[model samples]
Target chain A: MIPKLNIVPFVSVDNMMKLVLSIGVERFLTELAEVVEEDFRRWESFDKTPRLAAHSPEGVIELMPTSDGTAYGFKYVNGHPKNSRTGRQTVAAFGVLADVGNGYPVLLTEMTILTALRTAATSAVAAKHLAPRGARTMAIIGNGAQAEFQALAFKSLLGIDKLRLYDIDASASQKCRRNLAGFGLDVTICGSVEEAVQGAEIVTTVTADKQYATILTDNLVGSGIHINAVGGDCPGKTELHADILRRADIFVEYPPQTRIEGEIQQLAPDHPVTELWQVITGQIPGRRDPRQITLFDSVGFATEDFSALRYVHSKVTGTAFFEELDMVADPDEPRDLFGMLLRAAA
Target chain B: MIPKLNIVPFVSVDNMMKLVLSIGVERFLTELAEVVEEDFRRWESFDKTPRLAAHSPEGVIELMPTSDGTAYGFKYVNGHPKNSRTGRQTVAAFGVLADVGNGYPVLLTEMTILTALRTAATSAVAAKHLAPRGARTMAIIGNGAQAEFQALAFKSLLGIDKLRLYDIDASASQKCRRNLAGFGLDVTICGSVEEAVQGAEIVTTVTADKQYATILTDNLVGSGIHINAVGGDCPGKTELHADILRRADIFVEYPPQTRIEGEIQQLAPDHPVTELWQVITGQIPGRRDPRQITLFDSVGFATEDFSALRYVHSKVTGTAFFEELDMVADPDEPRDLFGMLLRAAA
Candidate 1:
């Protein structure tokens, strides 16, 4: 027997989609949403900290690493909006899943497309618990790369039927409408953000600008609107107006991180915000009144990545998505790493 | 041209060894040593912060991420010394190199073997500045997987001929000795750490115990010795006793990280160890007298990874180590990320 050397399972982007779709995306999304909620509810088990960032003039590259007692994972992602002009993604990512016991990577995957998928999955999961009862219409402002995911996730998880979309570039909204054509969601391309938010039960601000732009003003937001602020992730990148944040009952992933990264950055340091885990664990009220303007400031936490990785890991098992390349060598002699390399060379 | 979207080069462990050997291990070590010195001298230009570590009961997993305003890199590494008992390497790692300007990953490589190579290269570079002039007869306590690299780096950088090796596991010493058989260095396997360090000019402790089991006591110390404390990285993991550390004038790779994760963690917060950059830049004195003791308290900083990644990136330029998979899409329209996936599905 050749021994179980090079055990880190790897899934390329194409293989990942193949694996996800083989199990059916809707069922995978459902399971992922459930697991995300499960982990978010018990967030205390995670070793939580702010994402370590290395800021450059052009953009910021961040590492979001988290570990429970059993498994450890980290994502290497960068946000460069200007990159799209150069025929590249505004964001590209890859991550590693390691066993906590031996601290070796068990899995590695390309996270460029997975990030958008997981981000929307997390938003939909949060919306299931935080959105107003029987919410059907979702207003998706800043209709861009994340817009389609949000639309599909909302439709898949929360039974959202209608999407009112708006972006500064009208073509972006058109793209969103075209992408969701087969997804069976009634998407309306709005001329303005206010028009997009009109009569929408849930408003998702998933923009790409790396600035504190007011995508949702106070005048546009009405009562009973569940605002999923996903764009305001970095320190200076914000979307919702400070007034809109102040008026709504806010919920966050991690309070310490959300205070600097989420839409709540606009509010005072002491501005009361409930952690989403408290709501999930039934320790705090979630959408107590149907008419309450509730906001889930979804900055895309590490636990979401954890849930997505685990969900994908479970779904992709017994599938041919992994390519077992020679990565970490399990040496013939435990102490002789050099001898293995020498044999490999020979 | 089809327009290559994401071209992050990858070097696996097998290819990495071939790369090191192809580049001539001696020349690779020397070049990487020079790169480390160059990067360290411009310390303030980097995003200098301590690593974000996720500790487990067995070992610790860490993300040592850093950027120098232009290029960014981070190594995902683990230290589970007991893993060898289960037929796994005590350390395994991989890292990414990204363009900080665009936040796009330009390179990703397995750093398990690269780490040991770079760590040894860094220790040798520090020893170049801190060790006494024309020193030979180096004592390497705990001759494990990394001992060969340490021996070679010293041989290449300083022309050191004599090696006094000692390891509790006799097999480990045999492994190290076998790896360096024809590498043109006289190796003598000693019985104990004291015998190995008896009359050596430079002492390097590269043991792999997780706890503060002092491998070098005050009795083992000699005059004019430069101790490269390579193991004892992470809190509560120390190789040298407090008295030995107190007697030796220590230098470290980032004080914040070294204080928390290096041998200096055993010392008080203000227990004065000079940053290696100061010595390299001539701002601080190293080896004041020939009789004075010097110690390079190496906890393996991010800057070294940055330099190593840069070196690997240069060496692997036209080599066939990279696979340009469809990780990030280059659709006709940037907003049609989903459409591209749909088309690929079709």
Candidate 2:
């Protein structure tokens, strides 16, 4: 039987800006967070794999794909540190959502912004389950492009009332403060990583140096502080030092990947760490004491993207993302893939 | 400085059909063949990997990604023999080509149809180099979805004027006959595999069963015949009998992948086979002698998809796909991804 020409919905970056504006960013974040939570709850249903990364001299490009029985999704993302000098973001991405039942792509969306939103939302999910109750203060070190999202997610989800932000580039810190000004949180511009980490209920390090920068040293990390380690997410690129990882109880999205890409990469191959899902599911201990330091090595995983794509697809339904794309050959005759094209020409 | 939101081109199945049709199927094949040949010549420039495949109980899903510094492309494809029974095609795919400089997808297109086109185009390109001069009669064993394309490609590229076709399903053979009738080829409906193989200059086995289907035994293959084996692309899915592969001078797309996914999976890991790229570049021998049995153990590769994506992208330049997607967030301030949404809400 000839499958009718498939119509894939296309979401351009311009329209994406319009859609996010129409949806209201707060409501979008809330909905995205819920989707993240829901998908994480049923994690085993997905056909998961560690993303395929091709490292070059400049940066890296990766393809992340996952599928449940019904639908498949994948994101193509690249990270080039030098891109900023060329007016490009360090990370740019696009993704596809397809019907696994038919193997036809149904939705194609620009994922550069979606990835940022999802990454922040993911950290919030981890922090909510692992952090101390009524956490009110967060120190956001490495206040680059992702800092504001991390700050807002903590504010929206974890009840963070104040942000102690720090960055070597003081302009980035200034930008972070300016961006989060009216986002319903008190902000403090800090002088150093140590100052940022001092007495805060949570510490978030999202520094983007493509090296072992050691943005968070061991001595600064204290008890009862939940550290959302976001930036050290590639092989040879790290933020937390080996001692800090050893001292703090570490949680990861996926062990196989975290071993290579997370802060724990500095630790032993047999380093004891808990999977965040286990903590979320209450299958493992999160924090034994209020004074215990919890470090979530947030390298990200394909499952999170699966969750994010599922969330976006659901929200986009009937929301006018259905710009019909001629992605599949819906021929009058199935065997005539050639004939279909020939007729189209005629 | 915030980069401009990426405008990814969307090529739907319909657009692809229209594009292929407008370009003319023969010209498209000829163009695509040239694309493959040209890329094959610069094989060393690509960051190539034998596609990352996830095998399951039902079938397999694979991500074939390749980049050449400037542009990166990947194809998401699946093979499930049981899918047809469930009202799905046995194979379905879609792909994206992106600017590595910006990490934004430049083109997103459904590859279900494109896959068939590229496979046929690739096989024909191989045949153009390896098939004996003035070869007319081709035996197409196990005529399935790809059978007609194989027929037309050989006819167009290698001047094969007569088709000796056989399928386990008589309806499949009839489909092949009906599809190719407009092409003006001398088509012969053979009853058995042996009958189809007899006296043919080139033999292409494009079967669909996910088993060790012995479509061609050694005894049936005549001296100086070219065997284009296309169906035995995944583990446990093979076409040629062990004796046939053992005797034939095997040619493959990529040896590493062919060892696992092609008919060569039946042979030893150390078994000798020439990569078609080598033959294309004249770095290795294709057919040792005119009387030798030559086999192109074609397990599709990412490089082939790279060639196809490039060809399609160039043809559809300046064409407007759709301007309604709201997927990328661009704000006056790059740091204000959240504020951009907030401003939109206001």
- Predicted complex 2: CAPRI docking category: acceptable
TM-score, candidate 1, is 0.97
Candidate 2, residues A1-346: lDDT per residue as tens digits? 1134455666666556677667766666677887887777777787777888878778888998887767778888888777666556788777887666555566777787788888999999999888988899999988877887787778888889899989898988988888777778999999988888777999888887788888887788887889899999999999887887777889998888889998988988999999888877778878778988898899888877777777777767777644555555555545445556656656
For all candidates in order, the CA lDDT equals: 0.83, 0.80
Model 2 chain A: worst 10 consecutive residues (lDDT sum): A1-10
Predict model 1's lDDT versus the native: 0.83
Candidate 2 structure quality by residue, lDDT tens digits, B166-257: 98888878878887787879999999998988889999998888998888887888889899999999989998899988888888888888
Where model 1 places Cα greater than 4 Å from the true spot, the runs are A1-3, B1-3
lDDT top scorer: 1
Give one digit per residue, the lDDT tens place, for model 1 in A1-346: 1247556777787787677667665666677788888898778999888888777667778899898889988887888878778777787777778889999887788787778888988898888888988989999988877888778888889999999999999988888898788778888999998888898999999888889898888898888889998989988899988998878899898888899888888888999999888888989988888779999998888888887777777766677887665668567765676676667666
lDDT of 1 by residue, B264-290 (tens): 888899998898999888999877899
Per-residue error for A341 in candidate 1, Å, reads 3.0
* Candidate 1 residue pairs in clash (backbone atoms < 3 Å): none
